[model samples]
Target: MSRPRKAEDPIRLPVPCNRCGQHHQTVARWPDGGVCGYCYQQAKRTRGICAFGHEGVLPGIIDEQPTCRRCSGIRLNVDCVSCGAEDELDSGGRCWTCALGNVVDDLLTDPATGAIAKDLIPLGATLKSMKRANSGMTWIRQKHVTAFLRNLAVAPKITHEIFDQLPDSRTREYVRGLLTEHGVLPQRDELRMRYNNWAA
Candidate 1:
């Protein structure tokens, strides 16, 4: 007999999702129907008059019309296979938090080694564990942010000197602040530290 499938495992057989009309990994299945993770989440949040004449979150599809949860009795919980989060998942079967973590990891990884720079692991961990999932997700998608990260990943070394030599901009400074805060770069106010050292 085939091994029993876990509930967390997404049905990734590539079927057209009934909700979004995309042929992708479907997480929820009903009678000749399937819903992808993205659509599943959208459906759950949808508020409209369902086919049964009820006004609320219309999370079910019945005969090509939106249906109430009570009327449809559709089950929507599909734990993210990556982090086991019961929250809504992305097309890749990962929750928002896990997806953000992956994005951070990918950005931090050194292009040559296919792993995060040793000096930057702390920053990677810090970014991956950020509490606001939505903010982190949105922040990393900026073109400048991605460009800066890719440049950093290919660098031979990471240090204050390296950052200082780069062009000055708010984006660069912001990323530098996080690096210092997370101990990836040594925390030092160059002027202040120099003054204190000279005084000593």
Candidate 2:
């Protein structure tokens, strides 16, 4: 006769319900998350409504994420091309502030520095057309003082050293303040510090 049957023998297979909690018996382990034929059928019924509230296929249904909407969505935090700061709001690939008119300014004018400021218009026009996402050279070219060195004291990078040296007696403060207000520079303090450093 065979040996007495052992009543307390451990089972080799895991309990089915224990595998998937609610649908354990119907769920078979797959290379991905899990494979529940029953769950798959349910998901198919719920397809097309993106879980993200957008009008598109639900992400991760077929084990993949869906493409986001072109407009009205956050991309990621990034630095502002004009300000060199990461305080911009992502609206797709570009920041909302950049998309808006935060970097445009009327031409600078002052009776005292009128002639030299007029000479600076060419570089100003070039910067006006430059795209926010492109290189900063267009902005940099404005620093050269070929026509008149007396009016401009700033460098290409618009460093603190250069900004501060701007003759306070001239319209530089007003012009720089205008640029700062328009988002051409990061802030008034940054421009002011540069101006102060240069003055020192």
Candidate 3:
């Protein structure tokens, strides 16, 4: 009373089922799935969840020392220039308000006068010598001094200048002082002096 089954209608292949000892035939590879399906689902779920158990993939790397995006001082190691307090920078590194402190300091303590002295002293020495030769007016002639000061006020600022007639001791000492500030000259007393002695 039943129709004959075709050979390939549901091609049967025997596979062991975890739930039972007997093998079963099915169209799909897991047709009689039981404990095997549970195992597969469990594996899928475990793979999807990260170690933190959040439903997603875990990050490959984590940032250990993340600073504030705005200030870059999550730990607050940097000093704030504005309030002179140790605080995070608004934009990391030096804060905006404290950045111009250097310019302000320069304006207040500018070395323009010192620079002029260095430039004028050396060349002015020659002029002083010529004036002395022509007019016999000795010792830092008044006109030359005024001209030297005015010239120094403008450009090529220097630290110290040496005059030809005067002993070079003062110029050498000034230069030594400058060098000392930079921690370059180790010993000031040991420095050799060169001067044009008037009597010599």
Name the candidate that leads on TM-score: 1
* Local distance difference test scores for all models: 0.73, 0.39, 0.33
Q: How do the candidates rank by lDDT, highest first? A: 1, 2, 3
Error of 3 at 148 (Å): 22
Off by over 4 Å in 3: 1-157, 161-190, 193-200
Model 2 segments more than 4 A misplaced: 1-154, 190-200
Number of the candidate with higher TM-score, 1 or 3 = 1
Q: Please give, for residues 1-200, the per-residue lDDT of candidate 3 as tens digits.
A: 12333232222424543333334433223222422333322222221333343332221112422122122211223455565543223444543234333222322232654333333344433333342221222222345433433433453334333222223344334544544455433444432333233335
Single out the weakest 10-residue window by summed lDDT for candidate 3. Answer: 65-74
Top-scoring candidate (lDDT): 1
Model 3 gets an lDDT of 0.33
Task: Give the runs in model 1 whose Cα sits over 4 Å from its true position.
Answer: 1-74, 190-200
Q: Give the alpha carbon lDDT tens digit for every residue of 67-141 in model 2.
A: 222222323234456545343233444443353323222222333543324334444544445564233322332
- Angstrom error at residue 27, model 2: 99
Q: TM-scores of all models?
A: 0.57, 0.21, 0.17
* Candidate 3 lDDT for residue 126: 37
Clashing pairs in 1: none
User: What is the Cα-based lDDT of residue 39 in candidate 2?
Assistant: 40
